[model samples]
Target: MNGALLTTWRLWDKIYYRCTRLCYVDQQNNNIFRVVIKKYGGKPLRSEQEVVVSPGDYYVKLHIHNCQLAHRLAGMTGEMRLGLAALKEVKTSLPALAKFVAEHPNADKITGVVGTTILYRGAQPLGFFVRDIDSPLVRWYKTFFFKLILSLCHPEGVARIYQKSDKLVAKRVFMSKRDLLERYLDDQPQT
Candidate 1:
């Protein structure tokens, strides 16, 4: 999070956000996720709730703002503390995401939300269904990209990745529309 690094991150974030049209679920710089509505391209997936997401279905893809996350988590010590903080940030964003989907023009067409992450161990508890990436190429690409981001953002840097490589494999997480609404939305209508 040094001046130069921050500048690079800002530039990258700007480019990525524009190219992907990722909409912020909360305050621009402070939010943990940037999302885009996309058609599911991979094999069909079924959540624990028996919600089946098929190819060509429209869904929201959650993109973690890693640099922003790193900046927030910088200098935080201990795995437990970092994990808890990250989890808390995700929990906070759920309501906003629920609102976004509920208010979207294609709200009825959207089936659910999807995201890929290496940090998926705690996802099921949060109501996400974790699934292995079907394509080996995609799996490799995601793993490399996630680890690179981790190395760049983590306090321990490359050392942490080297030590924990095995546990860092990437996984896709799904939360169906029904699950998302049931978990994060209140009876009050979304504005």
Candidate 2:
């Protein structure tokens, strides 16, 4: 993002954070996730950890810090390096998130964690369950939003989106609390 765009995005991000009640799991600007407690909408979801999430159930909703992520990924070359860095960020984030959930006052009310992304491949092996977005409007909005972020963040910008348009569709990913705690809490150092 350029100077003006960057400023605008930062302003908007502030407003979005307030509006969504987003909480920073890691308490750092470079942290990958900002989350909010939200009630699940749409159809029921069965997570890999065997938790069933029904309508109105609460879960931690994740939002990627796109601008921070773009900054972290800036100047990197090669798709492999970028992919590996992103995976590392995800892995690095899990411990903090697990600690947050474990200590939350409402942790008992939370069914699990949920996020939507175009980058759904390889998530299953990491304990996430992928599903099609139930709402067409949501799907379209997420596609547009993520693509815009990608264009702004990617080194090649819009070209990369066009070249990989086929795989850019948005999907929902879910991870049960059981999976999150089992995979991250005991082994991960408290952050």
Candidate 3:
């Protein structure tokens, strides 16, 4: 039963990778605009908008929004499932991003989430999170000495850990963003 579950998980991971690739390709050809509303109800607002937003930022916003909706729809179930989904999405997208970074030597920098946000030293962002600070994956990634040793022993375990980590981050971010937005809306005095 465990074997069957593992196999199903693996297949889902592959499908996720394919979907991410397609999304990346589509995003490459698309132009995204970030519009900031400076004024609401004829009053000048403090927020400033950027004409272009990075894919990483866009992904973060999408993830946060999804998390909020999922929470609303499934309540606890949404929280559980969405976290898993976010982790899977991030894991599947990372390799392609790494490859893109390698090929684009002159790109600015890539941003990814680790314990905090990590800059990829190029124009691509690799958003990831480690499940446990003491997990082998985190240790291996930080130390870089036991790459071969760790890879040989536990690839799936590492992936799962990172996935769980990302899910936690997503949940936190979703809650915080939702709370802030709610507060902002609440503070607006109705005329």
Candidate 4:
């Protein structure tokens, strides 16, 4: 409960002022320069002054940000998978988890995945979305495409404001999880 409250507060803070500063070595001038990247309402400021990072600096900052995002996403996905795995023993487990995975077979789906990862034994992991993934060509396509999307979202990546749809989807997922827990915990088995 307390943790959730704190996360909410921190998220509010992060979104309200999603600013990132990157320090780069200006090769020509041999001087260190700072680039301020601000994402307002999940949109990067387009004005010249707003985006000062050079091509090299842009990559540097983007790479760093992307690395951070990947690490965080992996940690979260693993934790969610393990945590939900643990909950399997609970007789009243979440069923939506299985469906959610079916709809989104990739890690990003689960990581963007703000909802929950429930346990399931009666179903499979990779849904139709990634069932045949046998040939190298197909596999490469899937991997690279997901990575590209992740990169685009990296600079903003929840650090900035969320769109209305994003917020609603997240809320729906959370409510479903909450309802599942409540129903299972409180519902009396039909006698």
Candidate 5:
């Protein structure tokens, strides 16, 4: 990743940590958190007042603020793809999911929400929606034509496309060995 992307990822990491801590610490009440990015001296990024983080001038520093209980819940509502088919089947094995996530640096950075939901009123499958459609596309094609096609397709087609795209994303995100273990664990029946 480029410096700008790395910085953004790091900032997101800090936000995730703060949000999780807030949620864990105060489970009783509603918690909200604001993530702010501002140039130095309250100037815009294009302004001279902005502080450049690197000599190469890839990134700028920004101000961040959080409430007592940061909104970790906001993080918990996005699409995630687990490599293990079995785990994908169960859908509720959070510990297994967490363990799978812990194996990767970026994956571990993710908290709150994991896993994509296949919308359905009952047994009949309905559709799937990308939770964070604006989120950075981890894959090349996902950012370009493929994602556009998937988005514009019919509901049933969209679901199929999501399934295929998720498999590719899961492979990219998870370690093969760890993912296999998770898949095995997912296959086992819950007690």
Candidate 6:
């Protein structure tokens, strides 16, 4: 029974990856948006809205941050399931976020999530939290040791920790950004 469940999960995982990768974007400047017409073996899948991004105009979507704590703390089954989804989302998103930040280094007016913290940059610092850096050890970790270890492991990345901050600098930024995000969502036209 356990083996059957494992096999089913693996099959779903394969299907999920294949279905998700159906859409591809071409970055070449000369190409006028090429879309591949793939034929599925059986029933056709419904297509979502198509988006074309121009240079310097890209979308940065912010999903709710759900760490292991968030999943563990969820009391309801639905919440737990959503948290699990969030876990997967964060994993897939972090790499894409890193790639975007790398590709668009000088991107003017680049958008980002107002609520969350940025945990890594392309390999200077190892990890960071935005809320509180009251501890000297955390400061040391963010400043020195983390980067050293990261450089030893992988030098190409500039890892930066943007965890929640109680520090004077981040406090003001987070408060204002979060408020702006909330206001924007509030002002959206109702359906």
The digit string of per-residue lDDT tens for model 5 on 79-157 reads 3321132223324333343333344344422322211222211111211112322235533444444344333322333
The lDDT per prediction is 0.84, 0.82, 0.29, 0.28, 0.29, 0.30
Error of 4 at 108 (Å): 29
Off by over 4 Å in 1: 187-191
Error of 2 at 138 (Å): 1.7
Q: Candidate 5 has which clashing residue pairs, if any? A: 76-113
Q: Clash number for every model?
A: 0, 0, 8, 1, 1, 18
Instruction: State which candidate, 4 or 5, has the greater lDDT.
Output: 5
Ranking by lDDT: 1, 2, 6, 5, 3, 4
| Model 6 lDDT, residue 167, Cα | 23
Which tens-of-lDDT digit does each residue in 1-191 have in candidate 4?
Answer: 13453456456535533554443222232221222222222112122223322222211111122222232333333334533533332222223232222333341212111111111222122110102233456445644544443433333433322422122111001122223233333433343
Span of 10 residues, lowest total lDDT, candidate 4: 168-177
Which lDDT value does model 3 have at 20? 52
- What value does the lDDT take at residue 49 in candidate 5? 32
Candidate 1 per-residue lDDT, tens place, 1-191, comes to: 35677679878988987887788877653668888999988888886557557999999998888877887887788888998998887877787788788998999999989999998988888889999998999999999999988887777878989998989999999889888888887733344
Cα error, residue 156 of model 3, in Å, equals: 31
TM-score for each of the candidates: 0.92, 0.91, 0.24, 0.19, 0.19, 0.23
- Collision pairs in model 4: 110-113
Residue-level error in angstroms, candidate 4, position 107: 25
Please tell me which predicted candidate would have the highest lDDT against the true structure: 1
What TM-score should be assigned to candidate 4? Answer: 0.19
lDDT of 3 by residue, 70-177 (tens): 222232233356445444444343333333333333323322211211111121222222122334564446434222222222324355345544332211111112
lDDT of 3 at 151: 23
Every candidate's CA RMSD: 2.3, 2.0, 18.8, 20.9, 19.1, 20.2
